[model samples]
Target: MFPQSTQSPPTSLQVHPVPFLANTQDADELGAGSVEVPSWQIPDLVVECPKRPGARIHKGTSLILPEAGGDLLACIVRSLPVLLQIRPRWILGYSMAVDGVSLRTMYRQLEHSGPCVMIVEDSSNCIFGAFLSEGLRPVSQCYGTHECFVFRTPRLAGAWRTEVYGRSVAPTSPSQIEGASVPKPESEGASPPAGFSGQKAKYFEALRKAQAPSSSASVFCNHMGIVVGTDGPALFIDQDLLRGASWPSVGFGSPSLCTAGTDFVVRNIEARQNRFGIGAPNANERPVK
Candidate 1:
């Protein structure tokens, strides 16, 4: 999966860390523009559904999107009260142990920023979005079917971090957004990334190396993990999210997402589908301003 960033202004989700993915280092043309600032908060809703024993989260799930959303953040902000009200014993002390860039640097990148997107998975799997910033958006990207530690670190590379505890949201299909209604004709983005220039062969090579588990998950995290919210979200990425093709080398799990729980807290999360008032995820629809 080729990780992507929302170029235009964000929609329901606020792209925190305001600069998006800013590049601190300067290099030759090839390296100069490589670092993409993240802007949009890839939107996803929390539902109240029954939880099975193992890695399955999509069974008997209900659709939940907030209605009466005026702006992008409003849609996201709308859900906070609901989640807090339920308060189903949040997963605390979430630790991401995957090896990658230092937490110090990551903190600095996010400190004093708006909303930021954290791509936890490597290039092979679907990209996951985690908000690790100080800003507030009602809705947040939750994990579906993956075993990993995704904490809410709003100020990465900073002196301190505020963390949220919770059971991961299971992998959900994009079509499930509105819950049983005829899904939208398309997601927010109507077109692929502009200029859309890249090497398909090399991209495949990255994918091949990504799934191996032996390879660095950061590549996948940097490459395609951000857009893995759904099949369509994965499609927005560079690699094929569905093919499940093996990377040339073994892929480590989500690189950016540090998993820690050596001191694990096993929370028994009751499966509940959240009926958010919002409609479908405007995957293709974005704010122009």
Candidate 2:
């Protein structure tokens, strides 16, 4: 009211009030009009780490896996499924040094349902472990999904060499040979029939297919300990939890985990579980392999 301007207000200088804070409806309208950008398309995606440069992502101290340098831990995390790639707070569920060397005790400590990583450091200093789909328990029948896998980390100077062995996909089943024609055997020391060699190859191929282990034999546990394979266990931890064995297995198709030999003396064993919920399956529900 100080001075009434005779000139018309500038048409180009219209004053539009701007909101300092958007209401829920305004936010919703903005979001409805926006398009989500793909993560890969974004440049310089920054991953915030702890303030300390040399600090570890896993909070607690670990024996087999070093806390300061997370090379081995990174390998294990990379091997995990996509759903489990979330930043994890690894809680030590069981440690042989702290919890005592008892398989039953280990089972008790890991009774709750969730995926866990079992690490074993043998006498030769070779590090190996298995990613269990569910908590460790004594089950009469083989129980576990194909998510179970074995891994071995060989000690190398200034580097971590990790070998991961996944479940085997058996070859296609051989055709029905029940009523198939069989090649007649020739006289001893005489040349075989014209098509005998071909038939022999087919016979051996069929035999090998029959011997391959099924996917259902993923994991088995009893009163003794845990077994990874039915035919020849890729990894086995005894009741004492002091000794273990590894061998070439048709189940996981893994080579011997222990560098020393098939049997290995457990130096230190550590079982770690994610603190955050992983949406693991219930005990009653057997996941299809």
Candidate 3:
């Protein structure tokens, strides 16, 4: 049975700006080369890593993303909300290798109320993660905003693709959600109105389905561990932080983060927080509300 939380859920949604944007100047400078740099390779704008004699990898200092699989992290960053386009200093919040394999340790290390990026590398070498609106902790009810998203970098060789899935925002008006207008009632058995037909009808149907309301329970954290979606959670990490499962979810509408079916063995996991200001609390220090 899944463990539950005793703490009451927050009454209202708490939205926060996530620092994931890259400065245009930095992006231009980093992209200078004979070959154009992929969107995933956009260097971290906040850090100034000294150029090594023959370093081929381009990344920020103190980043937990590995050189070989850093593309996954980049993809997640690129898929963040527009307001969080600028990248900020990323401080390591937790690592299975350094902090031990306990969910409690991860919660303790990420006590601050700030945005975080959690990356998980499964045994099959599949890389995926979530752009969390807040740090990980055990909470009573569902939390997070539409800004939260889950992403996965396909492991296909010679292919650079990142699939990102996020919560669908409900439209306030009918016009906001585009779909073919319903035909007026036909006179008894009169010739059915020639509305959309063939491919056009299919297109409108697909569009309407895509705009349908999704589950609001984007995230649920309790004593058991973390679940990313309420309707068949897209991702679930156990309290031991050793095993996990992933599948398509209605909350984010994301496919399995790992290609190897629904279950996966955790290989390595890390959480990184983007520092806001000099006065901002570090991973070890809980922010003063």
Q: How much is the lDDT of residue 99 in candidate 3?
A: 58
Poorly placed runs, candidate 3 (over 4 Å):
1-64, 68-70, 169-214, 277-289
Candidate 1 segments exceeding 4 Å error:
1-70, 84-194, 200-220, 223-226, 230-289
Better of 1 and 2 by lDDT: 2
Give the TM-score of each candidate: 0.20, 0.59, 0.59
lDDT of 3 by residue, 179-284 (tens): 2122213443332224223433343233234333443336767667777754445677877888877755545655567888767888878776665433533333
lDDT tens digits, residue span 56-153, model 1: 22344311112212222222222233332231121111112211223332333333333333322322212223332222112233222221112222
Taking every candidate in turn, the Cα RMSD to the unseen true structure, in Å, is: 20.7, 20.8, 16.3
Off by over 4 Å in 2: 1-62, 67-69, 156-160, 171-212, 277-289
Candidate 2 lDDT over residue span 1-289, tens digit each:
0123688633221111111111233211323322232222211111111211222223342355542123345445655665665534455566665566788877776777488888898888788888888757777556677777787765552233456767666423323221111222354333332322454334322332344345523666666667665444567776677777775665565667788767788888877664442454323221111
For candidate 1, what is the TM-score? 0.20
